[model samples]
Target: MFDYFIAPFSDYTFMSRALWGCLVLSLSATPIGVFLTLRKMSLSGDAMAHAILPGAAVGFLVSGLSIFAMTIGGIVAGCIVALLSGMVARHSRAEEDSSLAAFYLLSLAVGVLIISSKGSNVDLLHVLFGSTLALNNEALLLLSGIASITLLVLAIIYRALVLECVDPAFFKSVSRFGAVAHYLFLLLVVLNLVAGFHALGTLMSVGLMILPAAISRFWSNRLGVIISLSFVFAAISCYLGLLLSYHYEFATSPAIVLVLGLFYIASIILVKQCGSFLMKRASLAKLSIEQPIQNPSSIHKGQSNV
Candidate 1:
């Protein structure tokens, strides 16, 4: 057990770094994910994930994979796309989801083209899938910094965020910070996506952000518990995924996401089964009560006939 689970981190520097990076990521990303899920913006997280690609790709082209360059470029691109999507949805005929979908698709294509033009298939793959095992001091610092900034900002905006999720119209009516919270939340999403891009790539980063939240919904309904559970789920997935990758030589990012996917599937199955069981019990109880009442009525009717 120790060799299988503990040895990897203890024996290998890269494994330890990967684990630390993933934990830090889960710290910030999972809560944002919970809020996104609450707001019914889960797909928006995915859209923004792809939307960051062009920026990261541009950074790659300019700086040849410098983490800072790609990160800045990705943040800038993600913010622009997010702002444009919101603006278009508000000011134009297209709805927010439609507009977001359109922008993400275009951003994805443009990003792929830019990366392919300047870099090899390997580089493109790195930008899409991430370099989990190759994280160094710079990448670690970036992840930590993003997580810290995200948590602090989230704390400051906690009330407004909750209000926005619970009742956007009401929040806007009562609080001047409604729009500020929305935009700031979007910024946080972009920031986390950019941070995840460094480790999980544009395609897979949102997995870290969204999947655990999805799983947590199966276990709890309270917002605080759900957020806490999500972080745990994400952390466990990261450990198991990294272990699988280390043992089987599977791609790290996909392995992590695959574990989360398995958890989601299991949660769905378990919830359905429990629900079915509860319904069956309720039905049986109802039938028993009804049967007794019917017997008493039949006895009364027969007595009257006699």
Candidate 2:
């Protein structure tokens, strides 16, 4: 039994590396996802994930599978989209979502065109889908480093980020950290998505950030608890997904994402039903206690008769 569960990772070096990469990513990216979900910018994160593709594609064209080149390219592309979308939303009459959608769609087309024109179909597949099973020391190191930087930045800016999400106008009034906080958080989002793209591909990277956060929302409303739960959910999904991929020969990234989807569905049903049950029980108890109090004369008459 132990070997059945543990041998795949223990016996295979690649499996272990894959586990480490995903676990680190889960720890760092899940928190950013939580913030994104809270700020109601989940779709924005999805858009930004696509936006990084052209930059990464340009990097690929220049360096040909160089991790650092692609990463830098992705970051530049993502930040450009984010800033442009924000600018358009502010300066023009277009909504933020519409502008982001337009930019990401354009970026995706441009990225695919560049890759297809300069490189092979395989290269295009790599950029769009990623190479999770082929993760090496370099890719792992890049993921770990990004995770470390993300955690540090998030720790330093935690309060400000929360304030900006909760009450942007209040944060602006109290200090000049409003725009700073917003941009810093967006930078963190881009960093996380780029890191995720290395493992999950541009098409699916946002799933790692968004699904665990969405799952946690079903279970808890407290920020700290929700954050912790999101990490736990993501880690569990990674572990299970890797195991499933190993055993079934399924695509690793999609397996991991599909497992997260399962968690989300289960959380919605179980957590919501549990909450409803508890609320009903509490209401029943409260009604029982108040019934006699509201009809004191009837209670006294029954007592005297008895």
Candidate 3:
């Protein structure tokens, strides 16, 4: 069992890159994911992952296998889609969800169409499903660079982001920092989303983005604890997924994603039980206190009921 788990590590280069990518991806995504889930923008993460396609297609058409070109295209497309959806939601009198659904689905179709029309030389399938084991040096660098930038930006904006998240009205009334921070946050997310596409593909990337964070929410009421736990959970899922995929000859990205999904389900059940237990304990304590007050007459009469 240990051998199987350690097998991937036997290849110093291949597994090293994968593990590094996974760590960066988990670190960048988990805290951001916590915010996204709390903001009800979980679907937006999914949507942005898919929306990166058109940009990727265009990049591949021009630059072929250049990860730099591909990343640029993905970030551009993601930002446009996010901004457009926001604009449509604000101006068209349309529901936010409806607008998001339309833009996200349309972007995906358009990406496929562009890829189809341009040429068939590329394996566009991998973009949708990811090829984690095949990640080259360039991909590792991209993941590293993006992760560093995202973390730095997130650190700078954490307080403001928290403020906006908790008190948007108060923030809006006082400073423009919230507005700037919001867009910057989205930009970092899109950048990371592009990197994640290489590691987990669009379909599974959303799970990594939101699932661990969602599960972490159950164990922590404090933002810092939830964020930390989320990162830990994501890291474990990545390693487990890689080990399982290698052992079972499974696709790495999907395997990792499925592990995260399993973790999320387990968390749901466990968290609910924990919550119920806390609530029950509180109720029992309240009842214990109230009993003495309600039965003052019994106390005065020396009537003790067990």
Alpha-carbon RMSD to native, per candidate: 2.9, 1.8, 2.4
At residue 171, give the lDDT of candidate 1: 86
Rank by TM-score (best first):
2, 1, 3
Q: Which stretches of candidate 1 lie over 4 Å from their true place?
A: 282-306
Global lDDT of each model? 0.95, 0.93, 0.85
Where model 2 places Cα greater than 4 Å from the true spot, the runs are 296-306
Candidate with top TM-score is: 2
> How does candidate 2 fare on TM-score?
0.95
What pairs collide in candidate 1? none
177-225 per-residue lDDT for model 1 (tens digits): 9889999999999999999988888899999999999999999989899
TM-score of each: 0.92, 0.95, 0.91
Comparison by TM-score, 2 against 3, better one: 2
Tens digits of per-residue lDDT, candidate 3, 1-306, equal: 657677568766677678788888899888888989887888888888888888987887898757888789998999999999899999999987788888889989988887777766346677777778778988988888888898999999999999998899999999889999999988977887898988887667777889888888878889999999999999999999988877788888888888888988888898889889999999999988997899878776776653
Q: Order of all candidates by lDDT, from best down to worst? A: 1, 2, 3
- Looking at model 3, residue 263 earns an lDDT score of 88
- Superposition error at 29 for model 1 (Å): 0.5
Task: Enumerate residue pairs that collide in model 2.
Answer: none
Q: How close is candidate 1 to the true structure, as a TM-score?
A: 0.92
